[model samples]
Target: MFKGKFRIVAVICFVLFGVMAYLSSQMSFGPRDKILPGIYVLNVKLSRMDRDQAIQAMKKMEASFKQARTIQYRELSWSLPMDQVGLRLNYEEEVERAMSFGRTGSLWQQFLERREAHRSVHLKPEIHLDANLLEKTVTAAAETIILPPRDAGLIINDNDTVEISPGREGRLVDINHLQQELIKSLLTDSRSPIPLKLVVAPPVRSTEEVSAMGINRLLAMYSTQFDPNKVNRAYNVSVAAAALDGLTVAPREVMSFNEVVGPRSTEAGYKTAPIIVNNELVDGLGGGVCQVSTTLYNAVLLANLEVVERTNHSMPITYVPIGRDATVVFDAIDFKFRNNTDYWLYIQSHVKGGTLVIKIFGNEQFKKDVVIRSWIEETYNPDTLVENDYSIRMGDRLIKQKGAQGYRVSAERVVMEKGQVVKVEKLPTSVYKARNQIISQGMAPPGDILSNPELPADDSPVNGEMEEAEER
Candidate 1:
């Protein structure tokens, strides 16, 4: 009985020691005897661990604690915020590395709290100058500057009355400079509005006004005395006057005589008659009008104007010489001349001394001695008389016989220059009719002692001797 009890006690003790060893392994802490005194508590908790799973539970808790302790808190700057973007990746990597080491639970919690606090920190931005604003200021400073506008006008002096001149006080503006200033101002960003400048320039004058002065001087030098009231009866001065209204002769320009005078006719209030072709009397328009054109032609030549076109009359005109006369027929006939001088010309026409005269006023060079002359080339006979023959008796006897005839004619002209022969021109040709010639005779009685008183005395010679011979 003593041996049995001793063996039983040994077996019970063995069982109890095994159970205690297993329980110690399952717990979060190692054995009390093996652990150091005042050791830091990890505070790891495992709610669903089996009693036999204490060793495996302790190993898992140790891994988690180490991973948490390895995690670090990071602070970032707003200017260089790249850390924020990389923060999550860095945190995950640190956790994985720490987990490789052994630290558990409460340590992991403390590391997470530090990381959150760092993330919550706000970063401030640094102060710096704006490059765009600086560049704009630099450009504005380099722009061109301009002056303001001012008023100005012309001034005259009593001593300079004879010579009209421009005043020094007149405001003058440089157009090119003004344009540049305008462009610069428009491009500039100014706080105040800049008003446009007003520029004053010298008074503008036309070319015509200058030319008028020259024309006036020329007219004063060459103007001649002429009587408008003495104009010839043949020309209708009133019509010519009307056509000349508002007519101006430019320098070195030609004027057409026919074109200006137009057609002369009763409709135009012309009462004068003109000789026409065939010597036959005919009432027509512009009959005596050639006198006007002829007069103007002479005046133009005297003025030394260049003749562009000139046509002679088909027949002689009593009013003017052959070559000197100009005939116009509406759109068909025309006489034109050019002003050959540098000055302008003024034309004036009037009737004087039973003649129509045209005067041209210009420079003195044209007013020199000038003359025209003309004459007839041939004379034509007038119409001849016709005689008629008729028979009649004192008492039924033939008495006498009669007969008749007719004739016609023309003339030409010779133009002279300075008493020298210049040209021989034929004027309008004239045609005349022939006159009739007539004769009459009577019969004599048979010879029977009949004495014919109509016989000449020469035929009655020695009548006494012939009578004596016949008696024998």
Candidate 2:
């Protein structure tokens, strides 16, 4: 009787095991159009949904993830827009992942996991980020916080001298390593600020190198003064002087004054001041900048450099001698010179104590004794012009404008080397026109009213104009 009972129990157990195996195999190899239960991705429920339905769900969630991310370096932060960084979800990859849930494991394992009241299984979505976009974003962030390495430079000191400025090492974000970190962070699906790593880069030119460039000794120096009381004129002078300061000119290089200083509009920090217009003093922009060019021209002359192109004012300016002044216009007229020496030339300029000073520094080749002289060859006397004015009393005399005398002058530069005159150069002759003086005398009879007389057309020359002027 006991043997008979054991045989019956064994037969029942075999039958139940076969049934379980068949059920597991059917679930594993059967058509799987929907996701298994207890699966979560991006905190969205995707269970019991077809592949297309799951894809639609992921698309909706992706829109919410497109938000600005913050990147931090020390205490500074930069907001990186997600759209610009090319952040998106791979719908096909994610759907394939969810669809393969019950089909991956062994038959027995799938049976156990797919059973009711089983432990929850979490899934990772296939998120895609553009590699180039990642690099560009990090680079932009680095640019904001990184101070670029600057080469050593020169500065104009208060005491009318040149000084060398030290270069500084700069820091930049390690792009390759940062990219790995960014990818890992995106995998985490966390919305926290990412920290940045930096590396040091050396400067292109060091301070010691700049100082040893044979620009130590002063070659030639010249200075001219403007009225400090005239604030606009003083400002204009300072602007031009600063633009030319600490400039380096290579050997045989030609530099134009207008090209170096640029246009002198109000946008360039020039103000209206008394400038010679039509051979008469009038308020105009960039009035006192010519004084700076004149000073530089004299310094270049003393240094024995070659004058490439130069023009003189229509009327002689009081700041410099008749033939020593150099005038410049933005696009029409220009003053240019070449660095004829073998060594490079360094220009230093400054405005202090109502004086604009320009100094040229170079090697020993430029150090020489030099003298500049100008002699008046011809002088033209001004003519007297009388006009009747109804505003003044009868027989009353008033000088409308003080006359300016014009002249032609010749200039020469003498250079001495080793106690002997080595070179003599004659500059171009300058010719100026005479401006007639105007005396307003009341010529109307008493109690006699006259119609308003039309004023004569103004013949004043425009600033930065040499149309009617000539240099021979």
Candidate 3:
């Protein structure tokens, strides 16, 4: 009977302990209600607090920490604001951790903790940072500290001498390393401004390298004049000349006119001007660029450079004689030459006072005296063809166009050494076809008394005047 009584008392005690533990979890606490002793969050006491009270206490502590933190760079310092860099805390996870101080574990274990309040629990809030905000901050700081390297340059003097300029080094932030430092700052609450790492950037080339190219001494030069009155044509001529300036060609390199000059279009700054099309004068784009090519062609010939490729215009141009003109049509036609010397060659071109000049420079051994010569080998006069138009008045004569004689012309390149002709190289011949004169004569009135029935003789006044300079 005594043993039975002890069992009943033990059952009652177990039931009472279960009810108290359930009530602890359900019941709310007042502002003054104390949490179990020995509970701390990041060294701040969170004991003797309810759920809401514990959260508020942590918020106040966080504010104070952020207010005192600063990131310093030299004399400049930036405040560590929770809002600016999107600093965030896992509030739910941290609060749950704090609340679990004595609430967790087996029934007996929990009861034991509450019985004496002897256990100590310490925890830190889980922190996070917005990725985009961190990236932006680091990138902005990088821009301020980064410097780009400057490449070496060339300066052409008034006397056609070239000078070299030194290049400069630059410093740039190492992004990967900077990002790593930023992560540490966010995770560890590090307030010190992180020192940035940099890499040394060297220029593409140095002054000493450019100076060793050996682009000196005038090998050959040529200049041609144009009418500045033609505004668009003159502008195109200037544009083409400017493109060829300061061009450097290595030894045995072939320089192409089309490649260097590029396309001749309105987008490329060429304007409409008179150009030869199908052996007839017509307004077209890049009209005056040919003059630039022709001028350069003569200069290259005078330099005794190897002519890799060249072609003349269909007919003679007024600026250069028949076989001397070099006509280019972008990708279709081109003028090219090779730098056959052992050293580098430089081409300098400019437009001044209505003249376009092209100068080729190389080593002294490449210099030569070159003379150009042209002569007509064969000539012929074409028969003048006449046309009749009813619009002309009766007995009134009109000459629509004057005729031009056809000729086959030959050009020679004369190379001289010490006042004696070393070689006479015959160039390609140019053939020009004659354009006939067109005459229009009006018809007489039908059966009129003023109209003479007999036609005029071959030596009549109208026919005799045309034969004054007859060759045959």
Candidate 4:
């Protein structure tokens, strides 16, 4: 009776094992239209979902996860725009990958993988970012945090001299490492701001290295005054001068002012100021730039350099005498000069205390005397300007401008060494056009007629220009 009972129990156990094996084999070998019972893509559970369903699920959350990325550098942070990064999610690929899981290999192996998925095996989703955009975004932000090493520079003295500025080391961001941190954070779905990694950047050129560049002494220098109260014009003067400071021109190389100075646009750090257009003071971009060119032109002449090309303004300017000024209009009209010296020509410019100064330095002794001589062959006075307005008081006179007189002037540069005339070079003939002496006569009644009061003189260069005037 006992033997019979044991056989019944053994038979029942065998039947149960057979049923389990058949079910596991069918699960491993069957056609898979849906993901396995426990599959995940980048922590998104895709259990028992079809490829389309899994794709839709990922697409729903992609927008929320792919943006709001920020990079932090201590006190500063930059939130990268989604458009700039061009972040994209490849949901279809991830869905297909999830669908294929546990679908290949031997039956036993497939069964084991399907089982492992249930306990939580994480797979990363395919994420794409525009490489160029990512690099630009990271680089732009990194620049703010990075303190780049600086080369030795110059300090112009009040007496037309120079002092060497020392170079120094600085801290710079490790762009590659920072880029990696950003990528890793995004990939790992970590939304916290990433930190910056920095490295040491040593200065390349030292004060001693700058001294060896053949800049031994000041060859010549020139200065022009301006009205600092004209805020925009004053700001523009400083901008243009900054571009010219600590510049070097090779021996015999002709340097174009426009090319060296670059474009005179708002993008190039210039502000609107008073400029000469059609013999009238008008508002235009890069107004005070001509003052910079004119100042440098005088310095070049005093240095005994060669003038390649130059043009004068339509009307005589107040900063420099007639035939002494130089006007530039970017790509159209330019003021250029050749470094006629045997050594490198180093230039230093500064705008301070309502005065703009330009100095030229080289490895040569400056001439004992350099004079800009000018003679006016013909001259004519401006016509009287009359303005009648009802708004002003009667018998009251207001002089808008003192007015400018026209002239035909010829100029030359005379260089002397040890009391002996060494060289003389003729400059372009300047022709200035006449303007009107503007007077406003009021129509409103007044008790008495008053003398026309002239406008107060200011350092603002009303005659400075940014565009070419009629070939004057």
Candidate 5:
């Protein structure tokens, strides 16, 4: 009876333990998992609970997530515009209240506590732009503008009565004034993209106008003196035209003859060979161009212009006097003169009937009475000759003689005022080499010398008489 009673109690205890295990397996805590009541033990499996709890938990989590997101935005609120300042502050306040409730462990926290909470969230950034404000700021900065004064009068005037007036004078526009105008225009309306127009006034004519004129006046002054056709005919097309063309001379400036002429090549139609460096004679592009420089040198001197630089030729030239010639070789050589007068000078070039002339016209105040003269310092006559004879024993027989030595000459320039010497300048010296004199061997002897001993003896007496007369 005791054994049967113990077996019945054990089976009852086993059934109770099985029922508790099945109940525990059917229980659900969140929306993703749920427990069903009275389900068979072997059939019990996990199931979706009323998502309202899970969803409610999620909703609480979402609210908590939004509060956390608001806190993050508040931290970054300083970067927002003025208009969003109040909005950002209000959102920060709501987040602070939510965090307070979360700390208290209220119903909202309980729902959130049922599941894992979201740790991160993303928020959109805002940008603000005001086109009108930008435009107003730009326009205010650009309100005031300054412009350069415009050029007003005639540049070249040909109509005249008494003296031959070349065309109107050329003028230089003030570069500073132009630059200021450009700056003002740029600052006024940066977006307008309109370029400021520069108005350069034509030259004015006053008593001072005569000096302001350039080479044009010089050319016109002497135009009537020469026949242009004849002057042109003398120059190679390239050199001649450049010579006749008016030159530009700035105030108190020096002009270079070769620099203005540039290079004379076949391309430039300069058929003659140019005088090269060190006054060495070489066949080059510009040959006869030196004539132009030489002519200008004379003109500058005649005008009483100050000579800044001038060099003589390696050899004497036929066109100008020995001391008056100016040689130029591009940058290496130059005939330069300064415009000492206060007024501008005009250079006019032209050819007239086999002559090349350059004229300089400026104020008379700067003009001076200038004169240049030169003479040979000394003359040397080295009439000595040396002879050499080689005999048949030393290969071929021959005779040789060296020629006479040449002379060295120096010259000077003198400036005069009111018949009084003001300044004197020493010119360069030149030395010529002697030529070699050679006499061939086996030449015919003089028959007169062999035929007359008395004539030879008489020749010495005659030479002696000539020498005595010279001494007396």
Candidate 6:
């Protein structure tokens, strides 16, 4: 009888424990759309909330974190929005994560999760930060705060005096450290304003360090003029010229136009302008850049440097004299010259008013007077071609198309020392193809000749300029 009584009490205890376990899981399984009770992320309670409600709850925390988040350096401060630096919390993932707690696992594990939820489960949201975006933001801020160092320069006085300009030190931000600090400030609830870690950046070299590394005197200078009214083309010309400023080449080194200027696209800050293609000028990117190269080529020739490679346009360009202009295309065609002298060759270029000028400098010992001479070796006028038109009279003519004159031009570099031509080097011969003039003759009568040999060949009039020329 005592044994029977013990068995009954054991059965009652088992039923009580089963009821308690079910009660725990029942708390977790209260509603399909709701999160279990007692869940929080960063002190923001998320219990009994749906996915949307939980996301809305997390945004409150985001707003508090983003309030007045500023990074200050000196007198400048950048108010960083979450999107600027690509710092954001994946609210959808966080809500899903919060909802997954008691709803996951088997019944036993669910009960355990529910029990743990009563004790309060706290978590941090998944942070998404793009390193590149962060760096760009910091760099933009640094650009505003930092003062760039100036390098020493030279000025040629009117009385033939060489003046050396002074150089100055600059201050720059500690980028890596600043990035770390930014990340730390973002991850924690630090209310202090972010401070920049700036470093003193000295000049690349002292002005007095080496005044003459074979660059004591100006070797040659060439200038080309452009119409400032052509806004896009002028901008491209200026950009290309600026790229060549302060360019230095050691002895035996070669300078390439395409390499220095790089790719000319909208991304590289070039606008569409007139470009020559198949001897016809059309709207294209980096149109006026060739003018920069042409000017540089003339300067290089006047400097008596060795020309490694150069190519002239299919047709004669109006900016430079025939056989003097150099045409360059990225990757496919390039303008290159070698620094044949023992001293360093330095190139300086700038655009002023409406002119682009390029100057070459090197040792005074290598300086020689160079005069460029060019002439037309052969001229080929466009031949007139007539097409009989039955709709018009025999002697009457209608101009269908205009034509261009072709030429074979030659250029020579006359190097002079002490007023005597020491060397005369001929440049590559340039040839332009003649475009045939088309004319329509009236052949209204059956009596009109099928092939008019005695066709009158006088042009009507030279009216407006070609549309292509105006673009240039």
- What does candidate 4's lDDT look like per residue over 273-367, in tens digits? 77777777677888888989999999988888889998888877767777898988888889999987667778888888899989888876543
Per-model TM-score, in order, reads: 0.34, 0.64, 0.61, 0.58, 0.41, 0.64
Q: What is the lDDT of residue 9 in candidate 5?
A: 100
Expressed as tens digits, the lDDT of each residue in 1-472 for candidate 3 is: 9999999999999888775654365332212344566677766687777777777887776564444344444565554344554555665567677666556687656666554444555566665556567546554544555677877766667887766677888775555665566556644656677766677878887666666777657889899888787788889889999999989999999999999989989899888876766544557888788889889989998998888887777555666665777778887888999999888888889999788899998887767799988888888676766666445456665665555566788888999888998888877676766655556565544344244334331211132222111100
Per-residue lDDT for 247 in model 1? 51
Residue pairs in collision within model 6: none
lDDT of 5 by residue, 1-472 (tens): 9999999999988877764453333231221233122211112111232323323433343332222111111112111121211212233332332233212365444334322212212121121223344223322332233222332222333431113243343332233443333233322322223222223444444434442442223212322122234322244523643654656566789877666677655665666432433322344455556666766777776666678887766544445555566666666777788977666676656664655556666555555556656555555453533333221122222334334334455655666667888777665565533333444233233342123222211111122121111000
lDDT of 1 by residue, 180-225 (tens): 3423332241223223233455335333443342433222111112
Candidate 5 at 381: error in angstroms? 6.2
Tens digits of per-residue lDDT for model 6 on 1-472?
Answer: 9999999999988977885667555465567788888888867899899988998898877766555467787677777665676667778888998888877777667677777888998877755567777657676655777776777766655443445676778877776676677657756777667888888877776576436554778899999888788888889999999999989898899888899999889999999987766655467888788888899999999999999998887767677788898888898889999999988877889898888988888889999999999999999998999887765666777776567888999999999999998999999887877767788877676565465455445432232212223111
Q: What CA RMSD would you report for each candidate?
A: 41.4, 12.5, 14.1, 12.1, 25.9, 7.5
- Pairwise TM-score winner, candidates 1 and 4: 4
lDDT of 2 by residue, 198-276 (tens): 8887789888777777565688899886668778778888998999986889888998899889998999989887666
Best by lDDT: 6
Once fitted onto the true fold, the runs of candidate 1 whose alpha carbons sit more than 4 angstroms away are 1-213, 216-235, 264-272, 321-323, 351-355, 375-472
The ten-residue window of minimal lDDT in model 6 covers 463-472
Error of model 3, residue 441, in angstroms: 3.9
| lDDT values for all models | 0.39, 0.76, 0.70, 0.77, 0.43, 0.78
lDDT of 3: 0.70
